[model samples]
Target chain A: MSTAMGNPTAGASPGASPGASLAGDPYAPQQDTVAGPVFTVTGQDWDAVVAGAAEAEDERVVVNMGPQHPSTHGVLRLILELDGETVTEARCGIGYLHTGIEKNMEFRTWTQGTTFCTRMDYLAPFSYEAAYSQAVERLLDIEGDIPQRAQDMRVLLLELNRISSHLVAIATGGMEIGALTVMTIGFRERELVLDLFELITGLRMNHAFIRPGGVAQDMPPGALEQIREFIKLMKKRLPEYAAFCNANPIFKGRLVGVGHLDLAGCLALGTTGPALRSTGYPWDLRRTQPYWGYDTYDFDVVTWDSCDAYGRFRIRLEEMWQSLRIVEQCADRLGNSEGDPVIVADKKIAWPAQLAVGSDGMGNSLDHIRHIMGESMEALIHHFKLVTEGFRVPPGQAYAAVESPRGELACHAVSDGGTKPFRAHFRDPSFVNLQATSILSEGGMVADVIVAIASIDPVMGGVDR
Target chain B: MTDPDARTDDDKLRAGSRGEAAGTAKQEPKVGSTPQGAERDLGVQEEMPENTVVPAGADSLEVIAVREGMFGVQGSGDTSGYGGLRRPVVMPGASPRPYGGWFDEVADRLADGLGADAQAAVEKVVVHRGEMTIHLRREHLVTTAQHLRDDTGLRFEVCSSVSGVHYPEDTGRELHAAYHLLSMTHNRRIRLEVSVPDSDPHIPSVVAVYPTADWHEREAFDFFGIVFDGHPSLTRILMPDDWPGHPQRKDYPLGGIPVEYKGATIPPPDTRRTYG
Candidate 1:
């Protein structure tokens, strides 16, 4: 890790002074020194010297704000230069969470990349998988109208993930501001969401459940019932959240007007999700660039024009409700399309022809195998070839963008007609969104920096990846 | 075969006149015929119609010739020859448009401003597989992109993505850069592709146009070794600064990492390992 030490003072070098006036000094030799004794005794000279000394004393102080700070949210560091308590300038220092997942994905097969990419943005694992899978599918040119059931399942899982992610954001943001109960409630609720995920995907954190062709498995029985119950429970719990945090006078005092970013600033800096919507852009990808049957769904693009910290908080809260609406619609869609194929028919991109024993200790029915192997030679051949060699993508490039919990998650993939991607770059929202923290924190009190950083809600994994 | 000189004369005639341009060119009529390239087990290329319209004029003729040659070498599969699935539906710019709603109107305005020579240079307007890729003469790429940004129907104010591709075996330019632009108000996307010779992969920088393009172009250059003229800062991003050769090129070897996870040794990239 290399460190960059920026210059801290004027007149620290030979070229420190501005160019001499051309009208007066074109032919004259430039002065290399002050051209006077160390102490000239005129009254104005004495005042000027005193003022310069005082100014030098008050120049600026550099404070490293992270790599392990409480308010940083993750392992982010902001090197801030302050004039007293007000921040003069702030430079964001990141990459503390560098996992080399993008490079690692090059070594893995196309399908295995999902397992690694999904973990980049832990809060929005589905969004990461969706973006990566979409890019690979574009390379293979295999967008075979993913089944309606699969689309609905994706929407359901994505929305649940969104709610779970926002709970963490709000919880951590509150904890940073000394609201202990919010953290407790937020984690408690998030645990329930993770429990739901564990039941459905069989893993808590890196659920490689969402793959290229489709989901890894069909929703486990009673998973929908649990989700429905969770939704009902959340409808009641949301008000408690509001009463505990949103409506609290102290919380409002800390958040409402601090870290204001208007629409123009948000757009200029490329902020999105709650940060952009709070500034009144209302540019949700689901509403604008609809993918995964989002065009068929009905939900409001939530927005708040206040462009303040409180506005961001308000937008996320409302977004949870909108997500709930999406979840309910997805549940209805899934109920109608039960027992359908979760994976697409293209065995080249789908999972291998094998089954795992269920919790009930029984493998999938023997008929499934006979139908795959004995019934369809093409399917069998594709399975054998794909499992052995993996899919070969044509030499091309694809950029797939999805609405992640934080903001737009775009994956730009390039292939050289090979089994592995040549280059896979993730335009993570957290990385870009963190840029606004400097703009928001400038001239604000040092204490407000914590509030501003929290409002941005950057996950270092997403930032550094 | 017909007289070659007569075909050139007919091509000149087609270039001179707009109404007779599509018909007068005496080249083989298999305009969009699929190429018969070496076959791989993976069915990647999609087949195209033999007599698809090829745009008239010198630049368009060159692009069509290149596209045809690509297809000739690589046999077009069952789908459209323009890569990927056959004719993916394009989401047209809708009225009362959702997100960046003003893109279509802006793109049109830009095209009109570029006038006929530049517009004629555009070879194919493809909206296959849901991606909008505009094929244009390599010479007119920067100019067309400028027009797209400045024109009315296509105010692609944001160059959201810029990437490179390598095709070592191809006869024409083996390296290409695909630029994705977004009209924030219009909510439309247009992809601009520029191909340069692999021997000296170079293209004009769009950094002066879109600031966000700086890092993306650098990354492309870093991985693919594609050079951008007049870029502010061109340097390696994800790889070590002193690394040799472009890692993303087709001929470059994929390096491996040796690791044992749960008592299983992960083999390197060169070693054969079943994906499943």
Candidate 2:
């Protein structure tokens, strides 16, 4: 730090003379007033502080906060220009986690694209997978042929993913602002949701189950019961969080009126999901566009007029409840839809791998292996052709979007009559929402930048991808 | 920029417009009724949309020689049997109206707004499967995007994405930039595409019209080497500051490593011998 102004007595001790101003009046005795010094100056350090106060410039200082910062949620670097404690300008630097997913997708088969897309927003993998699969389906012109059962299952898993995602958002948002108890509470609830995800999808995260044809397989036995149990647990637990953080003055103070972005700002920045809804606009694609038969499900698009960090947090909390309500409806629908096919009848696009749980965990079913290896040559050829080259989507392009936990996570797919994608780019909400950070954080205290970023909830994996 | 007189592309386009600007001048009444230019299929058998290619003789269109491999890989990497599948590089031709659904409405309205200039500015209008794509000349991208966003009838307020698609097979025009636009007022989405040659990838930046296109344009530049000419601070968005070649472009090598499992080692997918 340039502490030249920190010491006033460097020129005032013994034979030392006071600088120019004191030179004008030798005996005038300088108090060196800078507003009012917060503390009394007596020691050498104190004298140095007062001495250096005269040398201090009102110029701005630039602070580079992490690409490795814990509060940034991922490898996001923020360059902030500060005038004292207040930030004058803020710019976000991303790409620390660019995995080159779009490039990789060009090399993989159409079905393998889901595995890559799911990893973009690791928090809400279902949304990415669904968007990519839907885009391919749109290219195939079989969007209407997807089974009703699969559609319900998609909504079910997506809502579950949203709940788990929002839990992490609130948990991390709370922890960043020093709510340790909430961090524990949030993760604990998230574990339950993840456990349910594991029960149904085989793996908790990066479930490539949602494919071009339909879901990988039907829901396992009694997975709905576990979801029902989670819903019950969350119903009792959500109000407790409300009682804890919502009532805590420190929490409310740090959130409300802090990192405020009104409706116009949200629109200008193209921030959606909770951030936009926080501004009181009900633009949830689930409700507005109603993909995946979301219209059949019963749930309200939650909104809060606060338009600040508190509002973003509040909307996440309520969105989880709405997710729970939707999950409940999906569970009820699962009863009538049990015998229905998950993957569509189009055998060409459908993954025929009879997945089974062996001692080594999930793998291709032994019976399916025997059947394919020993049965008709046509089955073997069909299986080999589908698995290796995958099905070709006629040359075209389509953009598919879904309301992810953060915002509108969209995938734009271009097909050139090839098994692999010609180009697949996901318009990750985290990347878009993060643009508002500079606007929301500037002119606010330096610490509020963390709150602003937390409210924006950018996953650098998604942002960089 | 909207003045039809100053930015005419060719004598043919200029001749087509005539005196359409009668201060609200009499535009070509049927406004580019038939596509006047030739677009060759480059001899690669176009499996889909075969009936759509205009019967004009394939000449003057430079054909790119297809190398052996899936994508552009040189070796055995044909894990998927799609190798040697010659997907003919076909630039979509103009669709005849009733262009179907709300697409016609958007297209007709855009033509009326741009008047005679629409024929020159918009190179082609393609409706594939369900979505509509208006292929604009790269130079007119910014003006067209602004009109799409501000026009009361079109009100495509949201510029959803600005992504680059690289097709090395499409000679001359190898890099195509597509903008996904959302009209919130109309609850519709339309794609705007601009094709530029890989030799000179100069598509005008739409950041002034849709601020959301700012970082997206930078990302397109980073991944596909498409230059958004007027973008503000058009620096790399997703790649490292000093990263060399845009990785997403066709012919960019798939840098892969061999996979080792148990005792056996399998060559990288690109190097694996394929049915092709």
> Number of clashes in every candidate structure?
32, 14
Once all C-alphas are superposed, what RMSD does model 2 give against the true structure? Answer: 9.5
Assign candidate 1 its CAPRI class: incorrect
lDDT of 1 by residue, B126-146 (tens): 343355566566666677877
Q: Per-prediction interface RMSD?
A: 7.8, 3.5
- Deviation in angstroms for B252 in model 2? 1.8
Q: Give the 10-residue window scoring lowest on summed lDDT in candidate 2 chain A.
A: A1-10
lDDT of the candidates, in the order given: 0.67, 0.76
In model 1, which runs have C-alpha deviations exceeding 4 angstroms? A1-56, A138-144, A346-349, A352-354, A358-382, A392-396, A415-419, B1-108, B115-127, B135-147, B164-176, B195-208, B214-218, B221-254, B257-266, B273-276
Q: Which ten residues in a row have the lowest lDDT in candidate 1 chain B?
A: B85-94
TM-score of 2: 0.84
Name the Cα RMSD for model 1: 11.1
